[model samples]
Each structure stands twice: as C-alpha cells, then as structure tokens.
Target: MILEPKMIEEVQAAVQEAKCLGVRGQGTKPALAMAWGETAVLSTRHLSGILAYEPNEYTFTAYAGTAVSEVITTLAQNNQYLPFDPLWVEAGATLGGTVAANASGSGRYRYGGVRDFILGVSFVDGSGQLVRGGGKVVKNSAGFDIPKFMVGSLGRYGILVELTFKVFPKPRSYVTLQLQYASLHAALFAMFKLAVMPFEMDVLDLAPELAGKATLIIRLGGLPEALPGRVERMRGFLQEQTEVETAVLLENEADITYWQAQNRFDWAFAASQLVKIPVTPKQIPTLDKHLTNTLRRYSAGGNVAWVAADDMTALQTTLTELNLAGLQFTGHTDDPYLGSRKGRRFAQRIKKALDPNAVFSTND
Candidate 1:
C-alpha cells in the first residue's frame, strides 16, 4: 500500500509501524522504490512545498516531494539555477528522488554534482526521529556534513523531508561546438586534453557515429560579447593540440536541442535497458573499446557514460570485467549498483548508524 504522510509527525507515525518502508517520490524510478517487493511504499507526495527561498543568499529549501521543474522555474525567474543540472526524469521526477539517485547531468562538467550543491537536509531516520544536518546557509559547515551522505543513499538510511541547495546565477550567454573525430581514440584523446585545460566548459559530451567516427560536443557559457572570441580560441587550440578533423559551432535552437537531449539521455533511453557508468577520462578508451556495440554517450567530459543494452547479464559481466562502476537505471538487475566493495562497506557502516532498524530497503 502507498502511505502518503502530510507532515513529519505523520511520517514518523507511519514509519513506526511498517516492517519496511520503501521511500518513493512521484514514482519516477519505480525500480528503486518498488524493488523491495512486499514492503509498504512511503511516498513523499503529500509533504511537498517550498519551505524557503533566498535569491540573494543563493540558496533554497524545498520539500522532498517538490517537483524539480518547479524549483528550476522559481530559480529561472531570478536568473539563478542549480549548477548540477539535476537529471530530469520523464516520469515527473522529484528533487528528493534525484538526490537519492545521485543523478547529475552534463552541466556538472563545469561546477559539481548534487553532493556539492546540497547544503542541508531534514530527514526522518529509521528510528522515526526527525534529524537535521548541515545548515540552510552556505557558510554553515558545522558538524558531520550528513546532508551530503544522503546524496546517493537511495533512501536506505532515512526519508528526506526538506532539502537545501546552493544555486548559481544563470550564464549570460551560451556557445556550443560540435567537434567531429575520425575515431573513438581520437575523440577521447581530445576530450582528455580539454579536461585539463583552463577554459571552462559548461557541458561536454562524446557520441559515436557509424564507421569508427565520433563527435565531441562542448558548450561554453559566458558574456555574449566574449563568446565568439572564446569559441574561436578553443577551436584553434583543439585543432592544434588534438587530431580533431572538423569543428562547427551550433547556433540557436539546434544548440539548445542538443544540450537538452544529452541531459535526458534521449538516445540511451530508447533501448530496452539503460545504464549509467562512471569512468574517468583515463578509462574512457578502455571502456569505449568494450562498449562499441551499445548505443552510448560519454558525458561529464568523459567521467561517465550512459549506455543502452539489451542484455543485462552481458552488460553487468562486461562492467565487472572492466572494473568500471555502473548503475542500471532501467530494467531488472540483481543489484543496480556495480560500485567497488570498499564503497559498499562504507555505505554499510552509515546504513547501520542511520537505519539500525533496517526500515528502509536498498534492493533493486
């Protein structure tokens, strides 16, 4: 059954009785929230609203159930936005679920991810007690910084009720470039070089084309008057330093469409199973060599990859063999996460401390 609690007290009361509570928000990633089989669904739908927003302070607090689009809309009105570009779920994702999944988009290439922007949170622990961590203000960095620990906890420790995040002013102008390469190695070699450069890229991605061809898309955000000069300078640098065959600057609507499409993983989601794999620039060549058959896109300047594969077992086996971390976003998996065992042990310690009763489920 779905239990929607309107307030913290009600949430506590609901959690007090459930043998296990599968935290849910808008039911966007059902594979996560409902993967626990017979457990009761504790939805944050009713406990949604903006608690506080201070544009001048560059911070905002909203209920766990608040729609990400709603927060973005509010920030847009004031020329401010979440730098992390929280992944937008087509099934109407909520901010809480986004954080729980630790889903950040291509925009994170410049600034950071949800963990970096999150300043504080108010959650109901497994013990049915309300716990607050960090603070609403940016400078308030006192104590354990438990707020960030929740960034990718997947609601196993607690149910996030209220969340606070640091936001940034939107860029004045944006310039997008399509850099085409003759091969995957050539494209990734350029991507690695770009990663260490001084130029700030708002978004960077690489997608494979047919017949050993690949394309690297770079987005630059800055003042309108300075953008053209910066774009030309970067183009020249890439041409001189890397084996880039061609570079074309995207204009207007096409740029927006391409950027948005990357954020949503439009190509990967079309397949039967969609997976997000985390890999560093140094690992891209090796990872790409193994994933050539899959429809994939390398994002965050080659720090992560999103792939669409029909065989879950093969994908898991491949990831295991490569020693690359991956998380299945769609379809069934024995375990959605393929992170290191050391990381899992650390998570287990936190889980024990925050959820002694084992109230929340982590199964996929």
Candidate 2:
C-alpha cells in the first residue's frame, strides 16, 4: 500500500497492522525495490515536499519521499549543491532511497559520501513509534548517531520519514580534461599519481577508449578566472610525467555532456546487467582483467567501479575471487550483496533496538 502519510499518526496506523513491511520510495532501483519478496510494500511516495530550507545556512530538510531531482534543482538555484552528488540512475529516484542505498556519483571524489553530508533523519520504528536522530545542523547530535548508520541500511531498521543535509557552494565554472593512455594499466598508474597530488579535482573517472585503450577524465571546478591556469598546470604535469597520447581540455557543453553521460552510463552498456563494485585503484587493473568483455568505468577517484556485464554468475564468481564486494543495481540475485561485512555487530544492535518485532525486511 502507498504510505502517503500526511502526518505521524498516519504512519503509525499504517505500520500497526503490517507484520512484515518492505519500505520503498520511487522504486527506481528495481533490484532493491523487490529485494524482499512476499512482504507488504510501504512506499514513502506520499510524504513528499521540502519541509524546510535555509539557503543562507546551507542546509535543508525534506520529507523522505521528496524526489532527488527536486532537491537538486532547488539547491542549484541558490548556488549550492549536495556535495555527495546523489546517484540518479533513474528519473524518479528519491532522496531517501539514495541515502538508504548509500549511492553517490563521481563527485564524491573530493569530499566524501552521503553519510558525510547528512545532518539528521526522522523515521518510524517497528513499534509504530515516531523517532528522530542526529542533529538539524552540522554539529554534534543530541542522541545517538542513528542518521549516519542509516546510510546503506536498505530500510532494514525503520522507514525513513524525513532527512536533513549539509550543502556546499557551487563553483563558478568547471573544466574537464580527457587524457588518453595506451592501456588500462598506464591509465590507472596515472590515476594513482594524481590522487596523491595537491590538486583538487571535482571528479576523476577512468573508462575504456578506442581500440582497447583507456581514457582518464579529470574534472576541476572553481572560479572561472582561476581554472585556466590550473588546467594548464595539470596538463603540463601529465604531459611531462606520463605517456599521454592526447590531452584535451573540454569547455562549455562538451564538458557538461561528458560528466552527465558518465554518471548516466549512456555510452555503450545501455542493455547489460549493471553493478557497483567497491575497489581501490590498485584493484582496478586486476578487476579489469576479469571484466575484459564488460563495459566499465572507475568512479570516485578509482574507489568505486561501475561495471556492466551480461553473465551474473561469472561476475559474482570474479568478485568472490578478488575479495571485493559488489551491489548489483539490476538483475536477479539470491543475495544482493557480495562483500564482507562492515559494522555488522553495531548494525545488528541498532536493528534490534529499532525493529524488535522484525516488522521490516532488511534484505540482509
């Protein structure tokens, strides 16, 4: 049933009768929406609209059902942005869904992930109790840091009702450079070198190029007047230190389109099983060896790899062998996650306290 609760009373009533509930938002991520089958669906689709926004304070509180695109559009109007750059794989994606999944795009390379920017959240527990956690501003919380734990929770503990986020000022201009390398090995080597440098990059991604080659795309944002010099310096360093076949500093529409297409994966893998894999730059080349036939790109400065492969069994086996974890965005899987646990003990403790009756399915 659509849990379009206009107030806390409505939410309590909705949860009161359900034995097992599958908390959902827009169902943009099909795999996650149906992760737990046979459970009653409790959609946050009705709890829409921004509750509060203070552009001057760089913070905003929105209902859980608010569309991510809506939040982004509002923030952009004030020369501010959610630094985490919530992943928008599908158009109807909600802010709550993105937080629950802990999905971020290439922009997270500079600052951090969704957990870093989240200030607080309000949710409904299994007992139909309205609860809140974290603080409204970017300061210490009054109670437990439950909001941070909610990241990647997949709606296991409770159903998120509202969320508050810390925003950042957008840069005046952006510049992107495409550096072509002979092979993935060379491209990754250059990525490692750039990672340790003092230069601040907005986005860093490595993708396949023509003839089995590789391309390293670097995006820098700042004052329009200062970007030209920074771009020249970066270009000079790469030319002198690495074997770059070509260096092209993109401007205007070209730069915008490249980054947009990267996040949307609109290149070649439009019809393949897409998965997000967590790996270090050192592990990228190794993963690339197994994914030779897949269309893939390393995002977040090589910390995350987005791969599109047709064979699920092969992909899962490869991930198991490499000792890496993966979250398949699309496709069927008995277990959606293929990775080691993080904070399992702590998560279990919180889950027990918040959902004592197991009314919600975590799909763990």
Candidate 3:
C-alpha cells in the first residue's frame, strides 16, 4: 500500500518480492487493470522526466513515470507530439504505465496506436533482472517487437521502467467541424464514407441519442487556409449526397473543450465496471440493439465500445449472443474480464514462454 519506489533498484526489489505488482501513473483509468489485493504497488511519481529527445531524428526516450503532460510540453518546445494523444493528462501519469496498459486515444486514428509508436522498453522481469529490448533509434533490425508484446499486457509480464518512442512534429493549426445528420443510418454511412476517403481526421466520433438526430464531429489539422477547403469539401460531399439537416464549424476555444469531452471518456467511469468490447463495423447495429439498457459510449470511430454496467451476467450474455469479445474491467473473480479468448491458446503459450516463472505478482 505504501508504494513510492523512486529508484530502479527499488522497483526491481518491489516487483520481485510482491505476489502481484500494480504500476500506475495517475490512476486515470482505475478500471484499466483490476487490482489484485495483497500486492505491492509501484508508483512512478518519482521516476519522472524526459531523458532525451532529438527533433531532427524524430525520437524521444523517457522514464516510465514521466508525466505525459511533461513529455508533451517538452515536445511542444520543439514543436513535436506523441500523436497517440495519451489520456489522463491532469494526473501524474507515466510513459511506462501507459505502454504496459496499451491505453490509446482517438488521435491514434492518424498514425496508429501506442503499439505502433513505442519502439523499445526497459523492464525488470520476474527475476528482478533488468532487461532492455529494442533500440533507442527509430529504425532497428531488432530481434522482435518486444515492446508491442508488452502493450495491453497490463503489467502482467514485468515492471516497465523506461520507454522510447518515435515522435511527430506538431501541426501548424487545428479545426473541429460538427456535421449533422437526420438519422443513424445516414450519419454512419457518411462517416464510413469519410473513413475510406483519403483524408486524416484529428478525431471522428458520433453521438446518436436523440431520435432522428446524430452528430458527427470531424477534426482537421494543418495550415489555416487549407482547413477551410477541406471542411468545405467535406461539407459539400455530405450536404449533396447525405441527408444533412445542418452543419456547424466549432473553432478557437470552443473546439478544444468539445474535443476534450470527446477524448476523456475513460476517466468518467471510475466507480463502475468499464468493459471494452471490440466489434466489427457491421456489428454496431447489432450492438445498439443488444446492449440498449447498458450505459454505452463508443470511441475510435465506433470500432471500440465502452460499456459501464454493474451487471456482469447481462453483459456477458449479450456479448456471447452477438459472438464478440466482451472484455470485463471490474467484477468478482467468478466471472473473467476478458470474456472469451476464442483462439488465444497460442497467446497463452507465448506468455508462458516469455516470463516462464508465471510472474505470480502480475495482473494478467
């Protein structure tokens, strides 16, 4: 409970001794990985700061406990960004914890997810021995993508200490546009069209609660003049083809606030069980019908569904009926969080091979 390990040696000792280790930056996504009681907790508050950054080479290496805010601030000094738009910025979050949880936000739509950006990692494995995987540079003929494997593992394999990521230069400007549609079918169809087209949206999300009304927010970043042309093109395409009742362009201070709300949904469900269900684009309708009673908010252009509900039985049954993966966030031990691994036997075997000791201290 009294976890404030500052040094790497302390981290190794804590990880080796505890039955399970819960590493957290800011506790932003408390529902991310359930805490197995009677375990050692490693707080990355002390292990914070940017270790190195090179603007020309497009690379940044920082300690695990480094606040994403600090990283962004430092990156901004050089006009750079993480591109992934890591969440929980207000709290003291760390780079290592972020990679361990594999938590990504909507900005990931442009380049990719955390898994795509993280180039290397340093961790204290189950044996308390420090192991470094991958290289500091952007390109490397590494043995394998060890960093990617660590992602979404949720601190089950080891205690991630230091992280190295490829960075991108920040854009000149940004614009947010709200495109309205008369119905879900129309909005989603228009969204699908925009997705396939050759354009990059800062974030694209749909809020379809009011019957016969849907709101699709499209974000664009670039030189100021270029944004209007793109927005006009998007507006013309939607207005001419799709049934658009109206369209609104939100900018300056208002746009920032709107995107903030759209981005920070994970923290909203601190007390409830936050379940992430991955479904195909075609399954949204089925999901809308099946999980109607449950409080649901979607992100990543509707590819990921976040459901906060206290009832595990109903959630599992609905997900099972739809033949989808229902990853539970919080619940009694009787019901597993990751609903079904369908074909994860191989993954289980791989975990066994890597850690070998079955790191009893991790939250797999």
The numbered model that scores best in TM-score is: 1
| TM-score (C-alpha, index-matched) for candidate 2 | 0.93
Question: How would you encode candidate 3's per-residue C-alpha lDDT over 1-364 as one tens digit per residue?
Answer: 7477778898888767766566666565565534566455677768777788888988888888888888888889888888887865656556876786666776776777898888888887777789787775434355567788778766666777888889888878888887778776778888888888777787776656535466777888888778889888888877776788777888777877766665566434556676777766677777777655556655577777767766777777777777787655443443335555564675566656656676533434
Per-model TM-score on C-alpha atoms: 0.94, 0.93, 0.89
Query: Can you give the lDDT of residue 46 in candidate 3?
Result: 82
Q: lDDT score of model 1?
A: 0.82
lDDT of each: 0.82, 0.82, 0.71
Spell out the clash pairs found in candidate 3: 19-361, 20-361, 328-337
Better of 1 and 2 by TM-score: 1
- Candidates sorted by TM-score, descending order? 1, 2, 3
lDDT string, candidate 1, 233-322, tens digits: 888899889888877888668877766776676776564677788888778777777777778888888888888878777777778888
Scored by Cα lDDT, where does model 3 land?
0.71
Question: Candidate 1, 309: how far from true, in Å?
Answer: 1.9
Candidate 2, which segments miss by more than 4 Å at Cα?
Answer: 1-3, 136-144, 209-211, 339-346
